[model samples]
Target: MAAQRTIDVRAVGHVAERIYIHDSYVVTFGPDATSTNLWTLSNDGRRLDHLKILRTLEEPGGIAPIVDTERKLVAITGRSSGPPELHISDISSGDLVRTLMLYGSLDDVRMPYSSRLGHALVSTRVVDELPRVLVVDVAGNGWIAGVAYIPPDLRTSTDDRPDPQFGAEHITDDGDIICSYVAPPLPDGVDHFTLIRWNGTPNENTLPAVRADLSISLVDGDAVSVSCCLPFCDDALLVSACEAVQDAIDTAYSRWSVLRAIGLRALDTLWTAEPVWGVIRRLHHAVDAGVVLATGTQNAREDGGKNIPVSFIAAFDDKTGALRRLERVNHIAQGVSVRLCAATSDTVIVIFANGDMSMASLDDFLAHGLARDVDTHKVATTQLWKDDGKKVVHAALASTSVIVATQTNLVVASW
Candidate 1:
């Protein structure tokens, strides 16, 4: 007698990997949910089994996704923005299987990471005048899985290269040397956007003077937003977007008035004018491979030419790329223009609406310690600081959309 539900499960969009105690099977993400490539779910939201990885126009793209429900298998990683192909899909029967052939040029981006014994790390952007770091390794039986082609510039002499267990190199303080990149996050002299470990040694792979002023001009550069993370191995979490945003923060009334009280020395002088971090170096997991996560965001560079396209996030490595916590978010009468940057996890548990919900720790979004929600004004939950011991936060509820659980903190995405 349990059949007449009619179809209105509160509007829909509620997939679950366990939100607390609710699993009716809502795995939605079709209908171009803002532009597909949503997280290889398919447990019951319908289909795509494992790595069907589709957005197709003929070789489509969005790589960095896995489903492996004990090997039922699902690893989708796609990429196709006009002649840029690197796809691998096999969601039980979706097809495409294997296809990799990608190269990069200019303000390039290709960051996606994942691990937990699955293997899929891709870091692209090997264009030099100065800006290089190309790494690719994808193994999970779709095939071409392990060639280990990471050589754009890490100044090789080869001792098998890449150490520190795996993320080797990143010795900032004034020595400069962070070779363990995850890709798509450029322009660095290092100040506060890290996922490092290179303590010394740099024949070439640059970027680490520590910002007085760097400029790699993307112009306004699509209102910069960079994210770096290497969750556990010592320490690495660097988020940058020093603010000078021209447009597109995505709403919330322009991220609450450009997230007030800003200071990043004019975005580090547009990321040091334009050397693009000397010459790239991102070879995480060395070559054996295991922990990876990369992310990037852009939309604030306008010159009538407008080439705003930088959105990459390879996953699984402490859950998601190295991002501890950092929130600014102002409120200029809900226009919510553009402030930039948002990655959460450290455990946030919100529910609020007056019913009240609070659970914070992402280290209080660093430097300030946010708590706002004042009846859903936003930022429902935010706390991060977990090197592994429990103390996380990046929770959001009410409308739902903020995920990064399993110690990375920032949950609320049942769909």
Candidate 2:
């Protein structure tokens, strides 16, 4: 009924306030935390063995810790005060390998490590200036590539004040980087969002050239809520936008969220899917699989004018944008919001806002109604963290394990 392993981080000298898991290692850190507390959970999810605890930056910066599985490194950000710093450590030995102080603020969240080239990308800003993207060679311990929006000729101009912003979001498995640039507001109050790609290596000047760009207009006060690189397809991105529309009377506005699959090569819209009534809150890709799952809640008003929240799950084909499955979820009581959704190759993990978790079989859910004899095939679902009162702070679905961080304990559940 339960496949779970709970670790009392407090008893182990940690509050488990933050957790990052990748491949076979799980890292937990607090203000006074150590990397030596990282553990290797067995594949069966029944046990975990802690490695020698190596203390790291006790007061790391505001950036979230990142686990680079390919290079077997863990990158923790620097302190909040000074120029940003990146501390990289070996995952196996829990040893600090190198620390690189970057020219940026720790408040910036657009930092991602590229394992292919052993580089890290971060956005930096100066006083009253726009942000610039920089790439540092983690292995070489030097700045290798960078891109500046303010050209040399314009930097010295006194009258021309153009407000633009650029930052890197993700690095593809191949070494190419994906970035976003927000252009200045148009005279009509419209904004433009441009997605750029760093195709190849930088030139002799250490400047990266923009290989391709796709710009989308934000008219009528529309906003881009979320954007990220699509998994399994490096040449595509997933974007969610919220568009506000005026009613026929022109007195009020109503908003709707739209999800789009965009191709980078041709800068074209591959497909678009809009939820029936609500915004898409969580997006997760089943790694190495052709499925991406989206979960959200729909607010519908009844005849009595009472608003009710209904949670739903939607599965889409990663390549062709075909709708694979759409179902409404009611695992818990009414009015409970869905907190997070993570998918693996064959499992869909759902964590509710009330600290309840559920794991459903993806294969069984997709196989339903396919066989003639099995008229009503029900997907086998397993309830996790049953009756546990602790609040779920964060959760992740790795290869075969579900990592959940509660207020007092870190729970790992596997199939």
Best by TM-score: 2
Give per-candidate clash totals.
Answer: 74, 3
Per-model C-alpha lDDT, please?
0.30, 0.56
Can you tell me which runs of candidate 1 are displaced by over 4 Å? 1-63, 66-87, 90-93, 97-121, 124-156, 160-268, 271-415
**Alpha-carbon shift of residue 389 in model 2 (angstroms):** 3.8
Q: Candidate 2: misplaced stretches above 4 Å?
A: 1-14, 31-36, 52-54, 61-64, 106-110, 148-165, 172-175, 184-188, 201-221, 234-283, 287-289, 295-312, 326-338, 364-388
Local accuracy of candidate 1 as per-residue lDDT tens digits, 4-58: 1121111122232212111211111232322223233233322222223344434
TM-scores for all candidates: the values are 0.26, 0.73
